[model samples]
Target: MSTPTTAPATDAASAETTAQAHGVELTEVAATKVRTLLEQEGRDDLRLRIAVQPGGCSGLIYQLYFDERELDGDAVRDFTGVEVVVDKMSAPYLDGATIDFADTIEKQGFTIDNPNAGSSCACGDSFS
Candidate 1:
């Protein structure tokens, strides 16, 4: 007779942890744009990092870029092939935020829809 061995955490559990890791969501359009940008650069070692810094008219500004370094307490989420990371210090301010891409004559770029933002600047680039 043999005893059954307990398995490690399942994919669902890991996914759940990932979902709760950061309340930020990356839209498919944003993910596709990031993947295309990475492909154009001929690199795959970078991640999309979103951060909140002190600046802008509203006193807080958003910083989004491609980063290769991973710091401690960074919350990471993978949107298909693209990875999105948010530092612990910025997590609270970014919770429930959505990242999306737009390519149009009126505007073209990555946009953040943050529910946590009480009021944003006229330029729509900063929040209080």
Candidate 2:
């Protein structure tokens, strides 16, 4: 049998446009929470960076952190005063995704509702 081939990578501009079309959104609640967290840390130069990484029980994991570095091909969106950044590779996977904050008795943290996820693990931490 012949070896399978993979598609070539997209250019930065095209990738960004595609990502925008996919609809990655940060909810007002999430933005407010992020802003509060930054204020508590006395930081104003950080942006919330979200990305998908390989690993976890489901083969893919979501990574969320505050980053000051601006890498090439990073897709950024500003919700009021808060900024959210997603790397190019993770952009496609995060399309039509929403980031929200939950502050109920049962759950209290940031949550990601990703439409691109085909399957996820029990804890809802990873997806494939």
Candidate 3:
């Protein structure tokens, strides 16, 4: 049998505290959604990675996905059973950003509210 030594999953308050410390907030709804997705995948080694890449009409785009690799200078925060990771490069651009999931009749998807964005494209996919 393997040795058990990992820390327990953090609660919502701790998650929020971590979010404040990490500079990116992942809402409870989004965390729940991520947990569900991870449960479906049946792998506990994955972390939700968020990065800002140069592309799109506004010169920059956001990338969010499940990643099992841990790169250098990565800032990670755990919400319950889900972990959200942001690379050091993207941290400045995504500072104070709030990630949320909306399941409404009007719109259904993950949305990012970034305070660092000066202006965004018409399609709302990119920002300068």
| Predicted model with the maximum lDDT | 1
Please give each candidate's TM-score.
0.85, 0.83, 0.82
Compared with the true structure, all predictions reach lDDT values of: 0.92, 0.88, 0.88
lDDT of 2 by residue, 34-72 (tens): 999999999999999999999999999999999999887
Per residue, candidate 3 scores C-alpha lDDT tens digits across 21-81 of 5688899999999888888989889999989999999999999999999776788877777
| lDDT digits (tens) for residues 1-128 of candidate 1 | 99997766797687557544988999999999999999999999999999999999999999999999988778898889898999989999999999999999989999999999999999999998
Superposed by TM-score, candidate 1 places the C-alpha of residue 77 at a distance from the truth, in angstroms, of 0.5
Q: Report how far residue 55 has shifted in candidate 2, in Å.
A: 1.0
Q: In candidate 1, where is summed lDDT lowest over 10 consecutive residues?
A: 11-20
Clashes of each: 0, 0, 0
Colliding residue pairs in candidate 1: none
Number of clashes found in candidate 1: 0
> What C-alpha lDDT, on a 0 to 100 scale, does residue 12 get in candidate 3?
58
